[model samples]
Target: MPRRKKTFLCGHQGYGQICHRCDQTRTQREKADHARAEKKQKKQEWEAAFAQDPIDLRDLPDHVVVKARSIIAGLMTNTNYRDFGGKRLRHNRFIISIPVTRNYRMLCRDCGSFLVPEEVLSHEEYNVCKPGG
Candidate 1:
């Protein structure tokens, strides 16, 4: 005796009781949906994390945000700004600029005892904010 192919309700012919083609397609769709849902949830969590940051980092690139956060954490823990290659702005001694990346900088304010992160700005934005820039 040999198995015979039969048409399922989905119009797909297969040897199984159910349409394997449709079932395979449905499983693939479910997997895709699950993946999309997970991605959405991760994005939501990432967005929510910004609220806890001392400075607004929502607009910075992902890598810049992560670097800025690490710098902020280091500053909070009494790390020397010099260690991170940070320098006080020539025009504004109270403002410190720390390089977050080649194109981004993190500015912090001198608050007597500790540095308070102000904002993360692109290289162009930082230059525009400088005197005569």
Candidate 2:
């Protein structure tokens, strides 16, 4: 058999090669993969924690719903939405609105008007334009 060539940390007893370099590269790759997996897990956990539930108007208390109804009622009386503003009612408009993927508005079937739960609009006329009774 020929004399063995000088070899590095890899432990291969054949041709000239560095031994520990392969091990170091493998360890580095494993560390990178572990960090990536950790990042993905953290993102999934955050999404689960902050996920929103569907809105149901009926489930809300009477007091929470009253102002929204009144705002819609006021809009029917020829008042501009901007003028008939209530911060609290507008903030909670999601309660009355049917949840849609993209467009989130209370549609009135009677007059074919889109209504914002928080504001009054003379043109939208939610009272006259009754939707689903």
**What are the RMSDs of all candidates, in order?**
2.3, 13.6
lDDT digits (tens) for residues 34-127 of candidate 2: 9999999986864553232122334333443444455455656744445543222233332233321122233322233533443222223444
Off by over 4 Å in 1: 131-133
Q: How close is every model to the real structure, measured as TM-score?
A: 0.86, 0.30
Runs off by more than 4 Å, candidate 2: 1-18, 52-133
**Residue-level lDDT tens digits of model 1 in 1-133:** 8989898887889887788899899999999999999999999999999999999999888999999999999999999888999999887898888899999988888889999888888999978877212
Model 1: which ten-residue window has the lowest total lDDT? Answer: 124-133
What would the TM-score be for candidate 1 when compared with the true structure? 0.86
Task: Enumerate residue pairs that collide in model 1.
Answer: none
Worst 10 residues of 2 by lDDT: 94-103
Candidate 1: global Cα-lDDT?
0.89
Winning candidate number (lDDT): 1
